[model samples]
Target: LLSRLYRPLRVCGVVANDGQSGGGPFWVQAPDGVVVKQIVESAQVRMDSLVYRTIIDLEFLKHVDF
Candidate 1:
């Protein structure tokens, strides 16, 4: 199985949050169904929105995707 896997993968890095606000690595799905990594900041997301709230709740409620 390992031998059959030849696709390159990019790993995202994480660190301890120190109360600082800035962009962080995130996996964003494109219109064509391609998922790309990009830096996103808290300000860029609407914390009050239902979609964002559901995503956050789901992330903690279940096993996260790698």
Candidate 2:
């Protein structure tokens, strides 16, 4: 089930995960057949009257053949 959803995105050579802890849990294989395990740490800091910011780029999809 996971493979089906990831296959299309993987073919494009890009993948992204967003979650608050444990990093979404998944595996990715690069176009070169190199498999990689990713673990994105969840935010663990808080500030009074402060805002945290994060930016993600989706431009890779534009270059994807599929």
Candidate 3:
């Protein structure tokens, strides 16, 4: 039963934000200063906040290949 249910997963590409709803790949920095890839959710972040704008302007979020 487990064998029959087993399936491989593949990531084709990232889905960009449409300004409505959706989440995709993003680079986030940890409190320890270690940057890592995370699938950030739109609801988890406030898109219209000043901090968000500052992060974008500073290029804190980066694009990376998996």
Candidate 4:
């Protein structure tokens, strides 16, 4: 998965199956070797939504000089 993301230089969504019907975790490693993990438990609401949203908001603020 990390290889795929690196090749495309984009975010990828993943779903894991263990035959038990539950959401799994997603992970990404930065170019500087920082690791990030997101544990998702339900399809209704992602556990990483708040983190992703905050990152987006921060980027927006930087772009707008806010």
Candidate 5:
């Protein structure tokens, strides 16, 4: 018998609140019908939306830990 892995096989860096850090996360549908998580930059996001602005304006007093 084989044991199934409960946790994700890999975890990639997603969008961070800080302007200086990493890229953002987006959904990608695979040809096999599985949705994949991808990390993207600001260029991928629409700067015209209020939602995007809200995310950029969010404050962070300290470094967050996952």
Candidate 6:
């Protein structure tokens, strides 16, 4: 059921990529101050901004232990 799918986890997760794959995870802030995890593709973020790219790299740490 959707309720089972929506169950909260006791902890957040982080996974490292030694540079092979593309997409990564990030904490995106909502207008109301709620921050949620999002899986972002490399081409989807602003590659021109160093800050944004770096932040995206940080976000890349979470996900992919599977």
Using lDDT as the measure, the top candidate is 6
Candidate 4 matches the true fold with a TM-score of: 0.23
CA-only RMSD, every prediction: 5.9, 11.7, 7.8, 11.9, 6.3, 6.4
Would you list the C-alpha lDDT of every candidate in the order shown? 0.60, 0.36, 0.61, 0.49, 0.57, 0.66
Pairing residues by index, what is the TM-score of model 3? 0.43
Q: Provide the TM-score for each candidate, comma-separated.
A: 0.46, 0.23, 0.43, 0.23, 0.38, 0.49
lDDT of 6 by residue, 1-66 (tens): 585469875554445766676666666786877676666677877889998877766643554453
Instruction: List the candidates ranked by lDDT, beginning with the highest.
Output: 6, 3, 1, 5, 4, 2
Count of backbone clashes for each model? 0, 0, 0, 0, 0, 0
lDDT of 4 by residue, 1-66 (tens): 776567644454654343465544545465878786654455634447897546433433232210
Tens digits of lDDT, candidate 3, 1-66: 475349774555664434555555667888977785677666777869998756643432443346
TM-score between model 2 and native: 0.23
Could you give me the TM-score of model 1 versus the true structure?
A: 0.46
- How much does candidate 6 score in TM-score? 0.49
Error of 1 at 35 (Å): 0.5
Model 1, 1-66: lDDT tens per residue? Answer: 464357776566555444466555567887877687665677777899998757644534233333
Model 1, residue 41: what's the lDDT? 70
Ranking by TM-score: 6, 1, 3, 5, 4, 2
